[model samples]
Target chain A: MDFLTVIQLLDSTVRLATPLLLACLAGLFSERAGIFDIGLEGKMLAAAFFSAAVAALTGSVWIGLLAGIGASVALSLLHGLASITFRGNQLISGVAINFLAAGLTVLIAQDWFSQGGRTPSLMGGARFEPITLPFADALADVPVVGPVYAELISGHSVLVYLAFLTVPVTWWVLFRTRFGLRLRAVGENPAAVDTAGVSVIGLRYAAVVICGVLCGIAGAYLSTALQAGFVKDMSAGRGFIALAALIFAKWRPWHALYATLLFGLFGALETRQDVITAVIGIKVQGQVLGALPYVMTVIILAGFVGKAIPPRAGGEPYVKER
Target chain B: MDVVPKWAEVILVPLISLMLAAILSALVILAIGEDPVAAVNLMITGALGSTYGWGYTLYYATNFLFTGLAVSVAFHAGLFNIGGEGQAMLGGLGVALACLLVPWPHWTIALLAATVAAGLFGAAWAAIPAFLQARRGSHIVITTIMFNFIAAAVLNYVLVNLMRPAGSMDPATARFPEAVHLPTLHDILGVVGIEFSKSAPANVTFLIAILACVLVWLLLWRTWLGYEIRSYGKSESAAKYAGISPFAITMIAMLISGGLAGMMAINNVMGEAERLVLNAVEGAGFIGIAVALMGRNHPFGVFLAAILFGFLYQGGAELALWTSIPRELIVVIQALIILFTGALDNMVRMPLERLFLMIRRGNA
Candidate 1:
């Protein structure tokens, strides 16, 4: 492949990876604190709908972001109420949340827009405009490094840069903070954290809320930046893919970035069927490429490729001894 | 002794949960600027008002009966088999191959052969995940979910590249032979001097679903294997100490689950469509989850819950046809039912338990 084609593919990879990375980090926070959240896809879908709807209505992307976060956090609190407070099954709660979001988004969209369950195509300030980095234009005429910098990294929406930056921020907060230590401890062994005089429920809820916020941003990025508006089931199976990426990363933040980017590359390659056919000397089915991430995750999960051990307390509700 | 009475546990809990779901669904209708009462009225009349309506409702119920039982069987062994969608899809492929490859002399014989093919395909699809969970300690929930996507891809490839008829624009199999066409409800009822909707898709597969429900009840409550499965679900350590093999129970439970899910294709594919088509399962597999949850994973309860969902589905279609209400409202209701009955059961159960205790104290 030509250098420009490679650079273009990488650009799309960055764009596609942003949502998966954000959702992976979201799942990271919840799962790290001992709460398993399969509702990440649902939360992202809800956020995508509300963000697009609000942006189309009020013509303000900031307000739309807030609405998106509010919707996701509301669902997260519901998860907390069911799984944590009521001591219900976490996986069942996550399943319910996903169905709730999937149905509600289309229902509300249909009610409001009457255009077959989709928001209108966003315009002007309602959408996230791509931001060209400083010196991108000036360095365009330079050799290989210039195109790599300008074409591949320079022009992406503000959310893409923020998503990448959050990786380092997450690593710092997780490894370098007292709250992080307690959160990780709670996930591994809540009884120890409880013995240390920290409230396990409070820490877990905090983690869930943080998860909601990141997922909300991921949804917003999909609707406002990556695409022009909301579409039915727009989050698709990205949430599950994010979960797979989290497992592939072994629940670490840095590994999450690389894992999501690799999944994202698979997604990018899916769009360029000609490139794949040329390299392999045979036409590959698009569905095979589409199913790659899920198949890989299943392989990893079976421990054929690598073992992915979740947190010890993950998916279990905590109960204090009387 | 149980804290609550059996009658209340079976009847009152689901009743109260359904009411809560209905109230929330009503509010959602109000938010959409539609009349909740009117919508409910329309649903009732549309789904139950005529023979035609009952035909569609029963047809949908047949699909749910198979899938709901699929979920319930796995639930008994503490396994959540969410791969029903994938299993059902593969089952359609099985049905197609069975009907297309052979020229049967009779419909009954073709039905028997298709059922075996569909069940085998579904059980084979589920076995890998069950094996992983049983031997490798993989989470069945995640593995099954992954299998759903893979199954969808497999179906797409088979239909497009392998199964599609020559020169056909659609990614669907050619029509099945006349001998393989299962008798619909209209024909069956006609033999009994009863009139039914001629165009409706309700068929002999519905009877098969009812029979399967009975068989499942017999398997779960009457058999020693059922006892072992239930014991394993209640407590793995206790069951292990009691000499029940966890691996055997898990595999058996998932195989039954996958087989039942696959049988749904006999209704939608063989009885109704009479040919294999892409996206035939739609979201019925997920709807099965809601039905099983509402049914309390009991065969009888699954029967009742499946009918209720069938009513909602047919009625929702009517609403979409006549009114501005979207067909997806049924999905919204289904989600609420899952939320209230499965995830948030304690929200109603705790208060009911308190009430029951108060009544007992008064009696004392």
Candidate 2:
């Protein structure tokens, strides 16, 4: 209700939306290349664990980011091997990867840390410190613009900025680049791309790898930047929520930013149930707010509000004609 | 005309996949600095060495049987119902309502009513997704996943606000009436002078689960609708050309799947806990996917896979209680099995097919 409260909510919204935006963009890349990845959650969880674990061990967040990306890329390659090379069911492969990540992360975490499937809480340089933007302190006294610039926009971890920045980069790469054209062609009609002398498998694999990198950054952001350390099931369905956001955005990059931000707002509202109850003049359950994103996704998917059509060749393995 | 023998297709492939999964699980155990042999020994003895363990195993297997059959029925119709967890949770709500609202004079009647209520609730929960998939071209997988979360939220609301007994802090329904308690395996076996574990939760629902398996086999293989479902699954365009209705098959298959998944609540909620609680289904709905995958979507295969998982579950619990191996090892194994058998089928099948062709050529 108050301006400060609204700013604070928006700040948390930006923080929460970072992972979703990253993962949504990740899904956009993979799905646009004809590979449906439901395992985004699993990949994020694995990256979250490894990033935190390595960060705790080596005390370097940069090295941890690399490890996180490496973990995600490894899983992505496995998915590629199953869905692309072997021509297996993409959804089943995604499901397997998800289960594998879910189990292995906790299993290994318990084995190493013995903290009941949690890594040691990160501190100092091992975590991503908040970077206050230039003039944030100086402009604090100015009215609406100053508070918005200083309190809401500034003081987020570096990943938050990167996540937002990647949106434009993704839009440029997807719409303007030759590789992007070929990737889109592969997802829409792999045969046309193949006939044009591009290797469908290679292009798709590239897209999948890119997806892995983005998802890895998202996971590292969760454990290292957002929270202090990895917790069991810490991704906590964020992957699926990201998938929903991807659908809600209709697999577009810029739209993904808005979709993720909206979902993030729902998350912020869930955390601020008291504020919601005050505004509504009646008790509103956090569970209802928590379920809002998923419900909205289903409505979008069912084409109630608008159609969210996926790539034409999405979830289908490409087999070259002899 | 098949390259591989029927026996090999049905038995050998899964056997080899199971072996691969076992080897990978063994390596995982070794990586954890634990002896795989001792762990296996402990699992075997803990799960099958005594009636107490068997009770727990059978109880778990019963839950899997319903959920696994749920997945299998949908798999036959080419519709994946991954919302089994949500459906089962709603099913628990159904069972709770049926048991709590009516003062049933007998457990038999209560069981019948609860089964119907559970199935209806599960089917109702699944209906929206099924409708969207059938009519609107929405992906069933995504829609079903969304439904699972919604179902969880709905169940949470119901338990916390509506069902929770006054003054009780826990978000769970009040206990069902004593008269509605189903007979446990101990009580049933005791009548025949056979010893069984009294503390174990395995109950008459196990028999019901067995019966459901038989009924599902009959429905899929012996009925006209099953033929239509299989045909539709094999080739939708061909089925349509042959006059089979795609919408009808999808709707029917999903309803059956959701109903079967919902029936799992009878075993867990009514027979075991006798109270509806948050996360009552736990992860059994997801486990159903693994079971159905390993079982190759066959009723008989589902029965065996359910028992195997049941063993793993009970054994894992014992392992967690006895050692540092943590219970999540079973989940890893389950993942490996799904990977090998479902996703990476060609990884095994291609080599096996080549070997079979070579053997046949040599024989010629």
Candidate 3:
């Protein structure tokens, strides 16, 4: 492929990877703290709808972002209430959250906007605009690195950069901070952490809340930044993909970045299925191409790839006496 | 040790949870600028009022029964098989292939062949995930969820490119031969001198679902294999120690689950649509999860839950057709029911447990 084509593919990869990265990081926090949250999809959907609805109404992306976060956090707390406080099945609660979000988003959208379960398309300040980095124009005509620097690295929305920045921040917070130590400990051995005088439930709640915030940003990035408004089930299966990436990454932040980027590359390639088939001189159907990520994850999880071990206490609610 | 009576534990908790979910759903209706009482009245009248309504409700219930049984079977083996959606999709393909490829003399012969075909197809789809979970230690939940998406893509491709009749604009297969068509509920009821609606979709498959429930009850309670499966579910390590093969139980349970899920196609495809459509499975596979949960993983309970969900579905359709309440809200209502009965169950149970304990102590 030409350098320009390569740069474009890389650009597409970046755009596609942003939401996955944010959601992956969200999963990282929740799972690391011992709460297995499969409702990342639900939370993202809720955020996407609320963000788009608020953005279109108020014409301010910032306020829309906050509303998105609030909606996501509210659902996250509900998950916590069911799984943590009530000691219910985590997976079932997650599934319920997903259903609630799918239905609530459309129901509210239809009620408020009367637009067939879709928010009005945002314009101007209501949507995220791409920012051109300094020297991008000046270096546009330079040698091989110029296009790479200008097209591939520059001209992304603020959330794209923030998503990338989260990897290192997450690594530091999960490895270096006192809170991180307790969070990790709680996942691995909540009894030990509790014996060490830490409040296990409190730490888990914090992790879930952080997860909600990150998922909020991911959803906002989709509706406000990627598209102008929310559509029903628009988050689609990306939240599940993020969970797969979380497992594929072995529950680490740096690995999440790599895994999400890889998945993003798969998504980018999915859009170019015919091109790939033509270039490779092979017969590949779009449906088969679209199923690559899922197929690959199953293969990996089936021990074709390396082992993936989740936290020991994950999926189990903390019981003090037990 | 059992402060709450078994009847209350089995029946009252779920009933109360259902009431709670109903109250919350009514509030949501009120919030949407609709009269909750009217909506409730409409739903009852729409889902259960007449022979036609009952026909549609029972048709939907038939689909749920299959999927619900699928989930409950897996639940008994302690496997959370969420791939019912995918399994049912493949089953649709099985039904289509059976009806399209062969010239069966009658519906009975065709039904038998399709049932076997669908069962095998669904079981094959589930085998990989079950094997991975049992042998490779991969989590079945994630794998099954992924398979659901893959199943959709597969069904979409088949319907668009393979199944569609020549020059047809729609992405659906041609109608199945009339010989393969199952008898409708109206026909069977008429033979028995009972009046019924002619246009309702409920068919012989509803009877098949009831038969399945009885069979499942027998398999779970009266068989040694059922004992093995249940013991393994209760404690895998203990089962291992007792010489019950984990791999065998996992595979058997999942195969049965997938087969049950696949049988839903007999009702949806052969009975109602009479042709394979791209989204024939719709979201009934996911709805099965809620059904299994509300049913408490029992066959009879699943039957009751399926009927309840069927009511919600038909009533929701009526609301969508007549009122401004969108169909999507029904999903939210279903989710709330699942949340209360499945996940937030302890919120009600804990308080009731405490109350029962206090009563017992006072008596003591």
Give the Cα-based TM-score of candidate 3 against the true structure.
0.98
Candidate 2 achieves a global lDDT of 0.95
TM-score of chain A of each: 0.98, 0.98, 0.98
Which CAPRI level is candidate 3? high
Task: Report how far residue A92 has shifted in candidate 3, in Å.
Answer: 0.4
Q: Which has the higher DockQ value, candidate number 1 or candidate number 2?
A: 2
The sequence of per-residue lDDT tens digits that candidate 3 reaches over residues A24-52 is: 99999999999999999999999999999
Candidate 1 CAPRI classification by DockQ: high
* Cα error of candidate 2 at position B40, Å: 0.4
Q: Once superposed on the true structure, which residue ranges of model 1 sit more than 4 Å away at CA?
A: none
Q: B101, model 2: CA deviation in Å?
A: 0.2
* Deviation from native of the Cα of residue B19 in model 1, angstroms: 0.5
lDDT at B297 for candidate 2? 99
Model 1 over residues A1-322: C-alpha lDDT tens digits?
Answer: 7778889889889999999999999999999999999999999999999999999999998888889989999999999999888888888889899999998999999999999999999998899999999999999989998998898989999889999999999998888999999999999999999999999999999999999999999999999999999999999899999998998888999999999999998899889888877777899888998899889888888898878999999998999995
* Native interface contact recovery, all models: 0.74, 0.80, 0.88
Residue A17 miss distance in model 2 (angstroms): 0.5
Worst 10 residues of 3 chain A by lDDT: A270-279
| Ranked candidates, highest DockQ first | 2, 3, 1
Report iRMS values in order: 0.8, 0.7, 0.9
Tens digit of per-residue lDDT, candidate 3, span B156-268:
88888888999999999999999998999899999999999999999999999999999999999999999998999999999999999999999999999999999899999
TM-score of each model, paired residue for residue: 0.99, 0.99, 0.98
